[model samples]
Target: MKPSLLVLTSLPDDNRERIAASFDILYAPTHEARAKSIAKHGATIRAVLTNGTTGLSASEVDRLPALELVSALGAGYENIATDHARTRGIVLTNGAGANDDCVADHAFALLLAVVRDVPQRDRATRDGIWRDALPLRPSVSGKRLGVIGLGRIGEKVARRAAGFDIDVAYHNRKPRDGVTLRYFDNLRDLARWSDYLVVATPGGAGTHHLIDAHVLEALGPTGFLVNVSRGSVVDTDALAHALKSGAIAGAGLDVYESEPHPPQALLHLNNIVLTPHVAGTSPEANAACVDTFIENATRHFAGEDVLTPI
Candidate 1:
């Protein structure tokens, strides 16, 4: 008999069909459905497919006595009970590097959209307002960019910045080897030096609200901020206040603290642009992630090590 797999996140029909060919699927993409399915199929389930956002809890893992592997569809596993799962000998894997290009592309898209005031200009032009009626935006080329995390996505973002002649610097827990880019020991110092600040850090308790009022103030009145990382990294209240009070020139966000719902605090601000957390979402990226998950799961069931272990 094929191993049973519990799916906790929604997937495209084609992706679902692909997975169905490998294992017997127990589809549960909502809270209510998840509870019902887990209660009914816990004993038979040997594996699970989830995303970073809809993580598997320790309690849920405990109930699945047969579960041997857990796979996250994205690079993040912040919400997963990793330590507890490890204690039970459950293998954990993630889709790292699967969507790097897609996310890097979207990060630049957000940066340009906010810095050039693209959305606002599109609206003004539609209403017959000419260039003279609008305020002049700053040139993107030759500006200094500060990247918060120097991970795979950050490296891609820096490469793209090169085409615009933008100088790139970064801040991490420590300096990365072979990375000759300027490294800032402190986030405030990086913000002060950068004309554009892009956040690409992971989400977790450690990085929650890393970007607050003080960092925004250091970014200054002419600086712009872009967040392609998890929303928890930047405090929404602080960001709204910063934009409204001119602490920072403008902002662009792909993720926010309040997800699935628009950020209430930032809705009234004209200096900010928001996208519904789709930085790593494209048909090609999604296919890569799904393929990564299947490969990891297949290897795990075959008594082989996973490609990207968390």
Candidate 2:
């Protein structure tokens, strides 16, 4: 008999079919439906397929006593009560490199749109306005780029910056191997040196509010900021103030503090570009994520070690 699995969120049709070919895939329509499905069918479910943002809870795990594996596509696993699951001996894994290129692409897009004032320019063109009234926008090429938390995603962002010929410097716990990229001991120092700052740090408490008023001030009035990482990494109020007071030239963000609900103040600002936290989401990334899930799940159920734990 094939292993049974439950999909907590909707996936692309192609990915769904891929998963279905290996496991008896079942979809849950609602939270309540998920609980019901697990209670009714948990005995057969060996795996759960989910994403980091829409994570599985401890209660949900308890409902599926037979479950041995939990999978997330994307770097975050905020929704899962991991401690409880760990105690129960259930393994957890995530899609780390599955969407690196896609995320780097979106990050650069946001950067270009903000620095070049693309949205406003397009709107003016649509409203029968001309460039005579608009101020000159900054160029994206050949600027100093300071990237925070230089992990896999951060490295990807830097690699893209190479094409633009930007002076790239990054901050990580330890220096990366033999790379020519400049390393900064402090975030403030990095900000001070950068004309444009890109945040690619991890989310959670250790990095919470890492970009406070001081960092914004260090970035200065001529500097620009971009965050393709977590919203919690930035202090939203400080950022809004920075934008309002021209403490920084402008900003571009793909993620926000409130997540599904973007900040109310940002709605009125034209100095920034905003996206609904979808930097890492794409058809290609989704497929890779599901493929990772299948790899880990298959190994776990076959009484072998899983791939890429945590």
Candidate 3:
């Protein structure tokens, strides 16, 4: 019989059909359904497919006594109970490079949208307000950009920066080898040097609220901030205060601390642009993510090492 696989996150119909061809699927994309499915089928489940946001918990892992593999369908495995799964010898994998280009493209979209005041201008134009009445926005080209966590997505963001003639620098735990871009050991220093600060770091307890009030202050009154990574990486309260008080000029966010629901604190601000955490989402990206997961899971089932293990 095909291995039983429980799916925790919602997937497109086509993607679900594709996965169904490989395994016997127990589709549970809702909270109530998840509990019901687990209670009913936990003993037979041999694998799980979930996303970072809809993670498998330690307790959930405990109930799935037969689970041998856990796969996150995206680059992030932040919310997965990785240590617990590892202790049980369950192979863990993620689609790390699957959506990098899509995310990088969205990052630049946010940057351009905020810096050029596109949304606001579009609205003003619709209301018959001309360019002369609106406040001037800064040019995005030739500005200095500071990237946090120079991983696959960050590297793609930097590569896109080259087309705009933007000078790029990065801050990581340490300098990355073969990366000739300027590295800042300190995040605050990087913020001070950059006209634009793009956060692309991972989410977890270690990186929670990494971008707080102090970093926003260092970004200064003329600087713009963009976050394409996890919402937990930037503090929502601090970001709202910064935008309202002119600590930073403006911001564009694809993720926020309060997800599914709009950020209450930033809703009243006109200097910010928000997207519902869709930086890594696109038809092409979704296909790539699914393909990566299938390849990894197939390899794991075949007694081979899974690609992109966390």
Candidate 4:
């Protein structure tokens, strides 16, 4: 018999059909009727597929008496009650390496956009304004690039940087034992040494607002900042102030302090580029992420250990 599962995010017909063959999926009731559905059928659920923002909670875990696994469709599992899951003996997993390449590509894209002032340039050209300000745009290649958090995605970002002939340095909790790349003892030090500072750290209380005023100042007026990591990693108000006051050269952000709400502070600035939190969005990344959940679910129900345990 297939184990029963629930999906908070709607998948395409192909992915949905694939999973349906292996699990008895519990369709999410209407938004207004969700509470009623959980109350009535929570206990029978054995698996749940959700994302970081819309995570499975302590109360929801308690309600699902038979739930053995909880999986996130991306790298983050922030809102999920990890402490509660640990106590309840429920296995938790996420798509760790799956979306890494896609996210790394976005990080570079954002970095290039800010350093070259692509957004402002495009707008000016479209509005029939050219060479009036014809402001200087910095060269991306042949500069020192500082990467914060050298994880799988960070490594990928570095691999691409090599093609541009940019020297890469990184700051991690502790320096990696082997493999080349200068290591900085602190993030502030890395910012000071870098022409471009790229943040790829994880999001959570530990890393919340890690890039504050001091780090921004360290980046200096000629430096560029790009964040493809979690929003909480950078202080929005401080970043805006830095850009406005010209304390930092410019910034490029794919994620912000507020997920859905636009970062109003950045919108008005001609020196910045913003995108909705879609850094890890790509067809390949999406499929691989969902496949991780399917594999985790299958392993859990088959009495095997999880692949990417959290």
Runs of candidate 3 with Cα error greater than 4 angstroms are: none
Question: Given candidate 3, what's the lDDT at residue 172?
Answer: 99
Per-residue CA lDDT of model 4 for 1-310, tens digit only, reads 8888887765677777888989888766345445666788888888888777667779888899898888888888887898998898889999888899999999999988888888788888998996677878879999989999899889999999999999999999899888589999888999999988889988888899999999999989999998988889999999999999999999889989887799988888988889898899887888898788888878888789989988
Tens digit of lDDT per residue, candidate 2, span 143-201?
Answer: 89998978888888999998999989998777888868999888899999999898988
Q: Which wins on TM-score, candidate 1 or candidate 2?
A: 1
* TM accuracy, model 4: 0.94
lDDT of 3 by residue, 138-241 (tens): 89999999999999999999999999999999999999999999999999999999999999988889899999999999999999999998999999999999
lDDT of 1 by residue, 1-310 (tens): 7799999988999999999999999999999999999999999999999987889999999999999999999898888999999999999999999999999999999999999999999999999999998999999999999999999999999999999999999999999999999999999999999999999999999999999999999999999999998999999999999999999999999999999899999988889999999999999999999999999999999999999999
Candidate 1 Cα RMSD (Å): 0.7
Model 1, position 241, has a per-residue lDDT of 94
Candidate 2: regions farther than 4 A off: 42-44
Q: What's the TM-score of every candidate structure?
A: 0.99, 0.92, 0.99, 0.94
Native-referenced Cα lDDT, model 3: 0.95
